[model samples]
Every structure is written in C-alpha cells, then in structure tokens.
Target: MTKLRIGIVGCGSITKYRHAPEYAHNDAVEIVAFCDPNVERATLMAEEYGGKVYADYLEMFHNEELDAVSVCTPNLYHAPISIAAARAGFHVLCEKPMAASEADALRMIAAAKDSGVILMVGHNQRLMPAHQKAKEVLLVGDLGKVLTFRTAFGHPGPESWSADGKESWFFQKDIAIVGAMGDLGVHKADLIRWLLDDEVVEISAFVETLHKEDTEVDDNAICIMRMGKGSIGTLTASWTYYKGEDNSTLLYCENGVIKIGTDPVDQVIVERTDGTIDKYDVGAMSTNTGQTHSGVIDSFIYSILTNTPPAITGEDGMKSLKVILAALESAASKTLVSIH
Candidate 1:
C-alpha cells in the first residue's frame, strides 16, 4: 500500500488541530511538507507532524514530490495556494468558503480540473455521521417532504485563534472578508444544503455588528433562504453567544421534526401521524464528528487512489459558498436576492 505524499499550507490553529493531525493519523497519507508565512509556526507544526517546513508554499510545491496538499490558509490565500498546488500536480483539499471571491474559487476549480487532480473542500460538517444519516433519512423520504429547516453556527470569535489577540483579521473586512457569515454561517449553509439535498434559489438577510468595536465585519447575521424544491430555511450565525456551542440543524417535515447538535435535549426526534414518537439520543453521532476530519482525509486519499470524485468536491464547496455569498448580498441590499 503506497501512502499519498501530502503537504500542508498554513500552520494556523485549524491546521494544527484538524488538517495536519487528520493527515498524520491517516495510514494512506504521508505529510511531506508544510508552508506558512510565519516560519516558526510552520516549523513547529512540521517538526511535530514529521514534515519539513517552508515559508512559501509555492517553493514547497516546487520542491516536494507530493500527491496532495491541504490549503488551510486565510480566506484571501485559498485561491493562490490551491491553484499553485493543483498546477504543480498535487490534489488539493482546500478549507472552505472555497475562496474570498467567486472568481478566485472558479479559478482554483479550473486549475484542478485542468490538472486532473482531486479538488476537495473541507466542508467537514457534512462528514458528521448524524448529519450524514440525516441526509440519508431526508433523501429516503423518512421525513416525508421537507417543509422547513433552521440552522445556526457560531463561536465567540476568532480572537483565540488569530495571531493578533483582540485585534484580529476577523474584525477587519479586508483580510477576513466577512465575519460571522464567512467564518461560521457558511458551514450551516453547506450542512443545510447537504441534508435537504437542495440548492438555495433565493435569499433575504440581515447582518450586523452588535458587540465588536472597530470592526468592519458583522458579528451577527441572519439569512432566510428559499430552496429550489420549495423548502424554506433560516440560518443564523453570531459571535455573540454567551456560551460556546457547535453547529446544529433542525427540520420540520410533514411527518416529524429532526434536530441535531450538542444541546442537552434530544438530538433527533420523529413524530408519526398516529401520535407515536421516536427519539434518538444522537450522542454517539457527536462522538462521530470527532473523527470527521480523519474520515475526510482518508476519503480524500481513497478518492485520489481510486480516481473518484471526493466526498466534498470543489463544486460542492462552490454551491455552499454561493448560499453564503447570496446571504451577504441580501444582507447588504436588504432584499431577497436570486441565487442564480
């Protein structure tokens, strides 16, 4: 069994906790190198993960005989790094929102297409076993026609992860792109789309900064979406939560309501027409999410070896990104925006 030689771009906290560790743990992956503008961080991660480090990812691409790389950089750097890696004949697993803009996202996709290498996105939410099962249930009509869905994803803020303590790129529009929407809301958009098996057709939103001072991006955002299949959905993301929680999704169907998350209540519930109720703790599924990234990395390696589309392709990421982008536009215009 040959291991896929992998490189990692950007040695940030996400890279440290998720991407690098996931790749390192995978039997089919050998992390060959790492890149970051901050050489010390990159070097530390590289040494810890058994890889060499470089300040420039392009140099790593040029020098290493790698089969793939994870672009775990800031939103602004996603395109260039993925494009370069793909052009250098390395499959790319880019961290999400795809890119800062649609044009850059498309370019990265095109590069991977031209290179004939796998272009996977780290929309890790869809990998949750409970979320995956929810998708299966919805697809099999266990929910009996989706009527409506609601989801929310947020954290306190990115200050804990950012190098700049309180003054972080998360607060700056130029570097961060958008705050809660891009950072956390995008995951909700992706999960909702995956579970509902539908594309968002229209959107209306409100985005605002409620707490953070001297920041250009919204700390809170709410978006209403009309899916192509006539299912309406609502997404809320914020950094204002007094307590920290992970993502969760809810759906109201003709048959029952499905709920998911770390909340102390039922994880999923089913109510039959005869008034009988079926409840699943879904606690184990939360444990499953712990291995989601590892599953993703193994799946990526499997896809490359088998010559199959990744579990989450660049197109999948793009569709999810479009929803978030549409939400942003709708929030800015204060109107329902068509998601064409």
Candidate 2:
C-alpha cells in the first residue's frame, strides 16, 4: 500500500500534542515534512516523526512530495497556508477558526475547488463520542424538537497549553484575531450547529477582554443566538474559568432535555419529560489536560482513501465562522447581528 505522504505546517502546541502524534499513529500516513518559523521546533518534530524540517511552509511545499498538509498554524495563517497547499494539489486538514476572516475562508474553499483536493476543517467536537451519542439520540426524535440550548467552553487560559506559554500568539489580536472566542468559542459554535443540524441565523453578543492582562483580544464572550429552526441558545467562551475546563452543552427540547459533558462517568445524560433518564458512558472527551485521539485525523484519512467528502468541509467551517464574525460585530456595535 502506498502510504499517504503528510506535511505539517506550524510546530506549535497543537501540532505537538494533536496533529503530529495523531499522524504518527496512523499507519496510512508518512509525515514527510514539517515547517515552522522556529526552525528548532520544526527540527525537534522532524527528529521525532521522521521528517525534513523547513523554516517556511512555502519551501516545504516546494521541496516535499506530500498527499496532504495539516494547517496547524496560528488562526491568521490558516488561509494562506491552506490555499497554497490546495493550489499545489495537496489535500488540507486545517485547524479550526479556519481563517482570520470569512472572505479568506471563501478563497480557501475556492482554491480547493479549483485544485480538486479535499479541504477539511478540524472541528473535532462533532466527532467526540459523547457528542456523537447526543446527536444519535436527537436524530431518533426521542427528545422531540430542540427548543433552547446552552453551550460553554472555558479553560484557565492558553498559557499552560500553548508552546510559547505567555508569549503564545493566542493573546495577540493581530495573529489570533479573537482570543477566547476564536480559541474556544468557535469550537462550540461548530458543535452546536452540527448537533442541532441547524444554522445560527441571528446573534447578539458581549465580547470583552475581561481577565487576562496585556492581551488585545477578548478573554471572554457570551453570544445569544437563534437557530434557523427556531431554537434559541446562549454560547459562552471564557479563558478565566480558573477552576478547570468546562466543555458542556445542554439542549432543552419539547419532550425533555439532554445534557452533555456534565458528568464524569456519564458523558451524555438524557432526561425525558415523564421523569425518565438515560446515561451513556460513551467515552471521554479530549481535554487540554487529558489529551485523546481526536478522531479528526482518522476521518480525514478515511475521506481521502474512500474518495468521499470530508466530515467537516470548508463550507461548513465558513458557516460557523460567520457566527463568530457576527458576534464580533454585535459586540462592537452593541446590537444584534443577523447572519444571512
């Protein structure tokens, strides 16, 4: 079997903990090149993963023979690197918050379309075992129509998780675009949209730099959204949850409620109106502290090998990004923003 050749851009914490190790474990993939401005980081990854290190992604693209590339760079670089890879005829699996702006994301989609290569976004929340089970229950109509929902993703900031610690690009407005919203909020947005199988049509938000000092980007955000299917909800993303990580979602339905990630043993809990309850130990979610195989790499490889559309396509990413962008606008103007 001819293995799929992989090239990884950006040797940051995400690449180190998630992308590199996941790729290494896949028998179908051979990581051929690694690129990062910090040549030392790239070299270190190359030494572990058996790849040639390059300081520039463009140089790596020019030199290596790769079947796919993972765009694991800061939020700002997602567009350029993914676009370049697509144009070079390589499938791209880019990290979330797909690009700094919706326009750039559209261009990336166009590039992949023209190049006839797969372009997938790394929204691993949809692939979480709990989330998958929740979706399954919802699809069965056992919970009735979803009425209202609340989803939150909070952590004790990225300093401890990022490769650069306090100096990570996550705190830079220029690079990260938005702090908590981009880092954590976007994931929830994507997940909710998928879980409900609905789009957020309207949104009002309060996005502010509340806790972290010296960061231009927001540290917290709260968005009130109305889904196209008439379900209303609140999405909160925060970096000041000093207690521990909170990645949970609650869906209120016509017949009952479904809670996800609330219990340690039972990841998904379903409660019906008649006082019946069901618990599922679907498996653990991948957290910053307890990392697990995200299943994103496996799905991406499956799509390529089987010649199928990615589980999360670029269009799916753009729709989710629109929600975050709308939230930002709503924050600045202090008004509700509607997604078209």
Candidate 1 similarity to native, TM-score: 0.94
Clash totals in order: 0, 0
Pairs clashing within candidate 1: none
Please report, as a residue range, the 10-residue window in candidate 1 with the lowest summed lDDT: 285-294
lDDT of 2 by residue, 69-158 (tens): 999999999999999999999999999999999899999999999999999999999999999999999999977899999999999999
Q: What is the lDDT of residue 239 in candidate 2?
A: 97
Give lDDT per model, in order. 0.82, 0.95
Question: How many clashing residue pairs are found in candidate 2?
Answer: 0
Q: Write the per-residue lDDT of candidate 1 for residues 104-165, one digit (tens) a residue.
A: 88998999999999999988778766677677667778659889988988767777656556
